[model samples]
Target: MKRLLILPLLALSLIACEKDDDSTTNDPGNNGNSNPSALTNNMISVGTDSTSLNKYSAYVATDVNTNKTYFDIFIYKDDVLDRKQYMLLHLTEIPTASKTLNWQSGANAPGAIKADEFVIYPKVNDKRWFGVYSVSGYETTGTMQATVNNGKLTLSYEDIELADEFISVNVTERKKCSGKLTFLLSDLQGLTTTAQTLDLVAE
Candidate 1:
């Protein structure tokens, strides 16, 4: 019985030693080839009013009152699985004096005087999206999120957070700088996603 007990104890010790060896060999943190996945989408600016929207590189909006054109500016860049860059905007540059202004987030309209505007600091996860919305009380706000997918950067969001406000005049209009963007793999360079600098242009 003593011999049997000793045999089992020796086997247990050998197993423990093997486990420790395997743990050290498989340690990804200690491996020089291992890297933590981190990427960020940098937001430069968004076009809001007539002057800001006309020079946008993505899309164009038409002003009914002046029969002119406008463009919104949105620029973001990230390197996840691949190098991705995008710029999209809706061309609508009507003055805030011809239509009733109401903020719409997703499908619901949040009565607000104006949609909030802001920028998001670059971060990495998998995907990232940012946009402006009209919240309660004519309050405009912005939001951003990061998602992971096959180690790629493909994320987007465009549902407003409506604000509480009512239209008082026909000239009330609000231009929410909200849109979607995704980066493609062909834009990347190495195994690790690199940092990309995007330019901010207005139309």
Candidate 2:
């Protein structure tokens, strides 16, 4: 009985030691790599209505079960009327440098988003969500340029019009919104800081 107990104890100790030694993970988000943003205080300026969607915060997660890394910017206040509005930017790859990629997130509107597609989804609380696509030959014309460093982005849009989007959803239009606006990272407050300067071209 004594021998049996000793062997079990020894096995348990070895297992615990191994776990301690394996504390490190290969995840770029946790291993000091620029995979997911560690920066907080995120804000997005909706250009159309000239009403900035700076009502909340930004959330970051990594080592996802799906193995995808991305950050979210809250465009609407969470728990406000039991509603949550946010923008989800699913990182397509670990960007080594900043590039102005064509806005393709909502390209597959009224359909499933492509696996390789990089999109910014403005998610509403209900089943109805909307996607703003930057496709060519549309009445809407604009370009988005983004810079990602440490998983933080500076997204800017120039004179982009918001037409009827996916799922037959037109929240922006129903709300009467359109025009150029820049989306960037800042402290998570649904309201933009008054001290911060804004460009009023789209208005």
Candidate 3:
């Protein structure tokens, strides 16, 4: 009877050791190559007028290897006038200091407007402002200014519009976008918000 008891005890010990080994190997936090995922958030607000609908989505991400930051904002609007549209604003190499970036047509502005720097896609022609789908005649005109002060990030846009009335806008009337987004860098670092930036433009 003593021998039978000893055999069962030995088998239990072996099983426990196997489980411990598996747990250590499968732990995500222990993996050296694991990178943090993007954070994402959604917000809804009432439009200035009763007939308007406003929805905004924001995302923020930082690459652990390069420490580069990327941000994106999507705006959706609807109204009684059948004005259903979407606007996208993406930024790369975003300055942590107070600076303004702009993109225009047929002008050479260093660090201001480049395919790898900033993009504002208004869905004017069902094409993106950057990358392979970039429109030929369509041009993006906007200002993206950002400032990092007091451990907070302040982002603002002014009169950001897409020019090319025929194929891009698809409507006789033009649309102008302007807004402000402010949040604390500490909150983002803590992963307090679920907002994660998406890479709409590949550069």
Please say which candidate is ahead in lDDT: 1 or 2.
2
TM-scores for all candidates: the values are: 0.22, 0.36, 0.40
Candidate 1 regions with alpha-carbon error over 4 angstroms? 1-139, 161-172, 184-203
Q: Please give the lDDT score at residue 187 for candidate 3.
A: 38
Ten residues in a row with the worst lDDT in model 1?
22-31
lDDT of 1 by residue, 1-203 (tens): 00111121221122123211111111111101101122122232222211111111122323344444333223334221121233322212212221222322332211111232222211112112222223333333434222333433332333232111122121122223333333332222121111233322211
Question: Candidate 3, residues 117-169: lDDT per residue as tens digits?
Answer: 45554432222222111356334444555656787655555444433232443
- In candidate 3, what residue range of length 10 has the lowest lDDT sum? 27-36
How many collisions per candidate? 34, 11, 12
Error of 3 at 178 (Å): 1.4
User: What lDDT does each candidate get?
Assistant: 0.25, 0.31, 0.36
CA shift of 123, model 2, Å: 7.4
For this target, which candidate reaches the highest lDDT against the unseen true structure?
3
